[model samples]
Target: MSLKGVELQIAIPKTFDAGKMADQHHQKTINQQLDANEALNREIERKQLAVNKSEGMDAISEEDENDASNNGQTSSEQNKKKKQQQEQDAQHPFKGNLFDFSG
Candidate 1:
């Protein structure tokens, strides 16, 4: 209600609920923790696989390091290492969510 031509503004605050705010904060923290744990798990798994492969290659049927020597040098080791390096270089240097539109 206005008296004459003067108007009055109310100072009432907006209907803010304290419980919902706390719940939202809790959910945000949980999500962040979950994301961090997932990243840690993936990194651990990758490292484990690398360790296993290195250990498991010991008994494999491959040219011995000493057998591939030439003039006290190993040509076979060099060639094999070079080939593996090439394969590694051929791998996309990027990890996760790679998209190549230049087909």
Candidate 2:
């Protein structure tokens, strides 16, 4: 029995192109990230608009208070108290001078 003239066949592994698969995966993730960013931006804009609206309402209320104060004596009492506090503060300087070594 001689096997010198016989040829043997073996199974070989096929090579796949990994670069294309990686490129496809990266593109999918990038699109998802962009969509999330857009959603976040829209949310931020909505919150900012709400904040602006509330601040406008606060300004209107402050204006109304000012108008009411003009016809009340409480405003004068408040002004006198504020003036007295200012005078007291002026008379007694800040204790921060303790750190000043420059005589």
Candidate 3:
């Protein structure tokens, strides 16, 4: 038997395009990353707004305390306390000269 004049033929199924699949996967990841970043930004903005509101409240409370203090004490008493504190500070010349964390 001679097969010199016969040629063999095989049909293969179509394969997926690896490059297209990779591109699609990359796009999905990028979108997910962008969504995460946006969510983080929103959270940060919310936290900053809360901090600002709290800071405003703190300032109001501090003002109230100042008004209360001013109303509660005489001006001479306040001046006397200030003089005493100044004298105490003068007595402590070596205060804050060294850092101690021995607690």
Candidate 4:
């Protein structure tokens, strides 16, 4: 096959440098994305805080309603009532012995 038929090819590498205009555009895009993400995060945090506050308020209101229904009795009065009930139960023991082994 002599040198009568031959072919040559070459590949040129592209420039990787981004000019000032392209760099500015890229930076603007990045800043916009960051701002949008920050806003979204703030909104999420606000909603979470609102939910927490509402839940706390609901718990407080429920406790208040319970106290109101109990004739405004304080925790001490409720505790005394519970102790009295327990003492009464103890005074009246079970009729049948739980340890009875007879068939």
Best by TM-score: 3
Say which prediction, candidate 2 or candidate 4, comes out ahead on TM-score. 2
* CA shift of 11, model 3, Å: 9.5
Clashing pairs in 1: none
Q: lDDT at 11 for candidate 4?
A: 17
The digit string of per-residue lDDT tens for model 2 on 1-103 reads: 5334232222111113466677889999999999999999999998877745457787678757756766656777767865886687577475545565696
Residue 95, candidate 2: Cα error in Å is 22
- Predicted candidate 4 versus true structure: per-residue lDDT over 1-103, tens digit per residue: 3332222122112222346568889999999999999999999998877745457787678757766788867889977876886686577465554766696
Overall lDDT per candidate, in order of appearance: 0.66, 0.68, 0.72, 0.70
Off by over 4 Å in 4: 1-18, 52-103
TM-scores, each model vs. reference: 0.37, 0.39, 0.43, 0.37
1 against 4, candidate with superior lDDT: 4
Tens digits of lDDT, candidate 1, 3-100: 34222222222223456687899999999999999999999998877745464476343436434443465778677876896687578766755789
lDDT of 3: 0.72
lDDT of 3 by residue, 1-103 (tens): 5334232222121124566678899999999999999999999998877744456787678757765778878889877876886687588667768867797
Clashing pairs in 2: none
Q: Alpha carbon lDDT of residue 75, candidate 3?
A: 80
Report model 2's TM-score to 2 decimal places.
Answer: 0.39
Candidate closest to the true structure, highest lDDT: 3
Better model by lDDT, 1 or 3? Answer: 3
